[model samples]
Target chain A: MMIKLETKSLREAYGLCLVELGKRNKNVVVLEADLGKSTRTVLFKEAFPDRFFEMGIAEQNMASTAAGFALAGKIPFYNSFAVFASGRAFDQIRNSICIPKLKVRICGSSCGLSDFGDGKTHQSVEDVAILRAIPNMTILSPADAVETVMMMEAMLDVDGPVYIRINRNDLPIVTPENEPYKIGKIWELRKGKDIAVFATGYMVKKALEAAEELSREGIEVRVLNVSTIKPLDTKAVISHSKGVKGIVTVEEHSVIGGLGSAIAEALRKEAHPPIEFIGIQDKFGTSAKNYEELLEAYGLTSKAIADAVRGMAGR
Target chain B: MEAEKVKELKKVALKLRSNVLEMVGVGKAGHLGGSSSLAEITAVLYFHKMRLNPKDPKDPKRDRFLLSKGHAVLIQYAALVELGYFPREELKKVKTLEGLLQGHPDMKTPGIEAVTGSLGQGLSIANGMALALRLEKNPARVYVIMGDGELSEGQLWEAAMASANFKVDNLVGIVDYNRIQATGPIKEVFDTGDIPAKWKSFGWHVIEIDGHDIPQIAKALDEAETVKGKPTVIIAHTVKGKGFSFAENSAAYHNAALTEELYKQAQEELRKQGELL
Candidate 1:
């Protein structure tokens, strides 16, 4: 009854996770805010109809309901868009889940311009910042389908409330099939010296590309993929950026309170290094015809990282 | 409920009331009126009703209690202290920095079930806890105390609907119908007339009683235990600042602090009622 991580699409990965959760744990429940199909938790409803709760578009109620389910000894994985999950249910997430430290995993897809065509109203670049502000909240922005599956499994092991931001777009598989995904640890994709490229969520892929582009210019860039945003791997971030002359942080989220800010805070405490942040600069993203255009508009591209790294390197 | 037990419970309730006022007086901060109104209900649940193991607050089989009207957490803290969850001396720690006692109920504290202060969210947490208990086939009841004014939150009804739909018989919701909210009378702010009827319409077994009546409150809870299907809602009519004269029925005390003179007046009033243990 092992449901392999069958789907590469983020939506499909969600469905697979729910189906696996239903088979293994009877206490595992799914809560949807009338966006079952969109969030891909409809798969759980199909499998364990009795355990699934359809809270009907009220994101706040859905969040607290998940907390209720957790109090009842059921592992509840809630699903909604990032905006609805974080914004519409900010108080609920803070008070009911984070403050109480409930074992609830909030699976918010379409984060950080994943809704390319949906524009500013749908894109949720602020979720990471908002969730990070709350104490005892674990935030994860998985890179691709593989990472999503890994985090979905990792969530069962981690105790307390977790916010797993999954991008709507399907990312190219980066981790080898056998590579174990550990929570609160960074993945050193490529080793280099002069500049360290710290990236998170979907930006990890762009970071790899940026590193390759910089390597051609003899500016050896080290790529570190940080999926776990909270309970951050401060040890790895500081160690990696230790001797590096310049550090470049990249994220699909706002420069405020996302990966860049987190890395800066850690760096500020340990050692001050010349750090250049390549992310959405304290502004909302516009609706573009496609995801690539949205990234370009926000300057969250490999070229942007490359330019930032080169600038910090004084090239 | 026997008269002696009823009298004992009333005494505990009054002590809890005094503790809440004392904490506010110490911290020089708190929701005085809301806490006073909720003291009796908190007393009935923590001291005499709910099955909680103070030694193991996270006991799986234990009944659950959530304070949805979390701003009045001073009342809950008072009950927790009197129930021996923590030392009675902790009463002085209210609103202090680096202390477990915060202005709002926080689950991080040893005995608190959920961190509640933002209105209209506690019942959902209780409902989830109750649903989980039922799924585990355990017979532990989950009690959630909400302010009457909190009914303005649509999620309360959503939780109510879900509880009855799931037939969560082990879930009990008690609304402290103190008739006053932050601004003024609840009727003037938002009238939720015939609350008992409203709960009944939502498919719950609704019971109406005086929130300050210890015997009636205990009896109503006992009656809920016999109900085979559906959840129960006890609309307990209460007086804001029940034992304190100056704060009573006054909306300003919802989160107001007592003056030194007022604190002495409140203590004198509690002494006169013979409720001081």
Candidate 2:
């Protein structure tokens, strides 16, 4: 499949989705924790001021309020940093949202290495891992701007609690705007027999790039963009890894309980292979010059992934 | 709604209290003191105040109740069982795996509005529910019960501020001021001075009452309904344990398994009051 080019930044994509969400449903309420502009919910707030709320810096209260809105028959989309959404307000999310199975969407913007130099405080490399432990939660990480729009639209249909992790930086548009948005379905971008690369969020494009690089070196690398982390496409993973040399899971989160852990769990009791996890190794991140350097330092680059794949393939 | 009904409600409250004691005494792991303290208030809400339908637990028009201090779930569970939300026999299964009644209230169980164990969160969730009801133009009121010790959480103040800002008159909060937390007195753990005055200052309609008095609890609920354009807070002064002289005002009974001798003694006392089943 060819990568489609749709020019839209992450912020702009979020703004567009907010606008669409605002127009499509009156019950749709947007909440921000002092980052309405950063999370790109300002446009929706301007249009639907009555529906949008600025809950100050209290992410915990913001989560509780969103759960409240859901109980009141409204679709509340709460925007906050991934760390605060998953760490600071975790109890609120688990209790108010997940326990009742309220239709609350916690949109965690500025996730993983997206914080760049803001360092460990802003970077949420372990959020996905933590949230996955909670029952009745739908975890999702879209690849790019188009994927973000698709996921935002798709979230309206998902009942119970939905958690979406996003980043601050722009990513290459890897999927076409017209791509069918079927959440929980993995899209196999490239097929090969050497190694199956499972990647999510901003790292999907990198995995595809690594696949291309490995293919030129006489290695058939299958690249899969695992969009929906929860309700994981286990069948896709199994078929994609059929007779493959090994499995390499890549993500922008901690390697502990992120995408790699999910894939490893699925492959553990089955036809398993040499598994390599590409993520932050159980440590806090730092303030870097840019997201690119942060990604490279965290071993999230295409070259790093390619090298890992080469090693797994015994090259 | 009548004198006879009030008498029946009081009887129900006593029965609820007895059921609470039996469950906690059997489980040997529950906030018995707090549960006993809030029994009458729970009865008043379930039996007289709130328009809840056990037959239609999911009735969208039904009132909502959130138990913020969920450690005292035996109180809420006892009331729920008596109200026919679940089998009255299920009360005996408290804290057991087969029982829907977990250590805390769960929404998965019938009549439980939300999952609560962590304190200082119920009021905010209540505020949100009230705000949502107001936004949807729903007439159903949202009620929440909080422990006096739960006021120590800073998030409670945030909820207080948000409730006033939203002007959620449909929300009613009741604080069971039993004057005891887990270890000891609430004053030692945290000082949230002047509970009623604090809520009043936050723009809420404040009512204080003897929580064990059914008529007083009823009057306070009636007064809260009249306070327009703002939410209401009822401060019920209650003993840690009531009806049982041995456990009354005793923090050690906060959670204690009643031995066979103690259970028999408590049962005899409850039977004399015509409360024991």
The numbered model that scores best in DockQ is 1
lDDT of each: 0.84, 0.85
Q: Point out where model 2 deviates above 4 Å.
A: A1-7, B1-6, B25-27, B274-277
Checking candidate 1 for backbone clashes, the offending pairs are: A68-B128, A68-B129, A69-B128, A72-B129, A72-B132
Write candidate 2's Cα lDDT for A1-315 as tens digits. Answer: 112325457666876787787798888888888888788889888898888877778888888888778877889888888899889998899888898889998988899989797899998989999899899999999898888888877778998999888879888888767667788899888878889899998888999888888888999888888989997888888877779888899999999999999998887778678899999999888999988987888788999899999999999
> How would you encode candidate 1's per-residue C-alpha lDDT over A1-315 as one tens digit per residue?
134765668678868887887787787898888878878888889988888888766788789989888866788989899988998899899878887687898988788898899888888978989899999999998877887787777778898998888788878876555777789999998899888988987788898998898899899989888899898899888899878879999898888888888988887777657888888888887878889988998998999989988888889
Q: Report residue B253 deviation for candidate 1 (angstroms).
A: 3.3
Model 2 local distance difference test score: 0.85
Winner by TM-score: 2
True-contact fraction in model 1 equals 0.84
* Candidate 2 C-alpha error for residue A8, in Å: 2.0
Model 1, B1-277: lDDT tens digits are 8778888888888888888878888326578898888877888898898888988888888888888998888888887777678887678766778577877887667788887778899888887887777777888888889998989998888778878777878888899999998999988989988888889999999899998888888899999999877998899999998888888899988887677888888889988887334
Model 2 / residue B240 / CA error / Å: 1.0
Q: Model 1, which residues run further than 4 Å from truth?
A: A1-3, A214-219, A242-245, A269-273, A310-315, B24-27, B97-100, B108-110, B189-203, B226-229, B259-261, B275-277
User: What is the i-RMS of every prediction?
Assistant: 1.4, 1.3
The per-candidate count of clashes, in order, stands at: 5, 2
The global Cα lDDT (0 to 1) of model 1 is 0.84
* TM-score of each prediction: 0.90, 0.93
